[model samples]
Target: MLVINALLRGGIPFIIMGGIALLLNYQEKYSDAKSTFFASLIVFFVGAATVIYNIDHWSLTKQSVVHFLIMLITVYPILLLSGWFTIASVFDALKVFLVFVLVGVILWIVMFILAKVFSW
Candidate 1:
């Protein structure tokens, strides 16, 4: 579903932002839930707009990669800001890496199902 895809693309960064806020005890400084929801909405609109704009101009493969990359680029900063890669232990980074992989897998599965259903 569109909602699922949007969540898949934006959920990690949103979570990271929330985690960082919690870790820094800065929950009051930022409206984490509102900001995350808005970010996800932006991502979803960007994706839908991209698809609509490219409907007659791009292949599915190209669109998929572009969309994925766009989502990744949009979220990478949150990962860094969340201290996801600067943990004191290797296991911590690995845990984050696993979560990233899991997210990717879920995104792929959803996209695959969508593709099949839409015959893309």
Candidate 2:
């Protein structure tokens, strides 16, 4: 179950990133699927490590929108580090940022609905 959550949390974002990258490729190709996938894997590792390094401090006993949003935002820069860390301009970065944000919104909705249905 833990492993699945880890995968979904990262995998869903990767799908979002890849899909957005494909769509946003209209303007000079900000990033590619390969880079997006690689970056998302890095994000998974980084996020997991952050929690595992101090498990007691970060248990998910309670879910809060603020914490979830902050974590989602944290992932954006990590994705940028892997995908657009070089000569990408702010506009290009913003494009990726917006993509993740849209995905984040969708993810939040899914999570909320799941919680409601499952009484989590």
Candidate 3:
């Protein structure tokens, strides 16, 4: 069936990338990985339905919207799996990353002040 083919066309890559990421960096402790994978699955169902219903007809020059949607479907699962597999929960990881950013900014400011004070 055409529908099944289209679903697979988008799904195979999503599953491969998601599965690989899950294997490589997956944390069995936190629920983030499972949640992300499930969310992506939901998105796939919705997106597939939208595609089947002829609702994705947005023009962008020569770029095919269907292809763009397929890419998103393919990429987001991998991204979620990779991004959420850390030991920390996704929220905690974001907070930790933010703290590091702040620390870097503070160091940069201190260096800038010292450079100005030393005229170098």
Candidate that scores best on TM-score? 2
Candidate 2: C-alpha lDDT: 0.60
lDDT of 2 by residue, 10-115 (tens): 6667666667666666555565655655565656644443333224455453334444555656676676776454426898787877777787668667866886
Would you estimate the TM-scores of all the predictions?
0.44, 0.44, 0.32
Expressed as tens digits, the lDDT of each residue in 1-120 for candidate 3 is 658855875576568646744764455634555655655564455445334433335453223345435544553444444544453577865654555446545754685587589974
Report how far off residue 97 is in candidate 2 (Å): 0.9
Assess each prediction's global lDDT (C-alpha) against the native.
Answer: 0.56, 0.60, 0.52
For lDDT, candidate 2 versus 3, the one ahead is: 2
- Give the top-scoring candidate (lDDT): 2
Worst-scoring 10-residue span by lDDT in model 3: 53-62
Model 1 lDDT, residue 112, Cα: 74
Better of 1 and 3 by TM-score: 1
- Per-prediction backbone clash count: 0, 0, 0
lDDT of 3 at 101: 49
lDDT of 1 at 118: 100
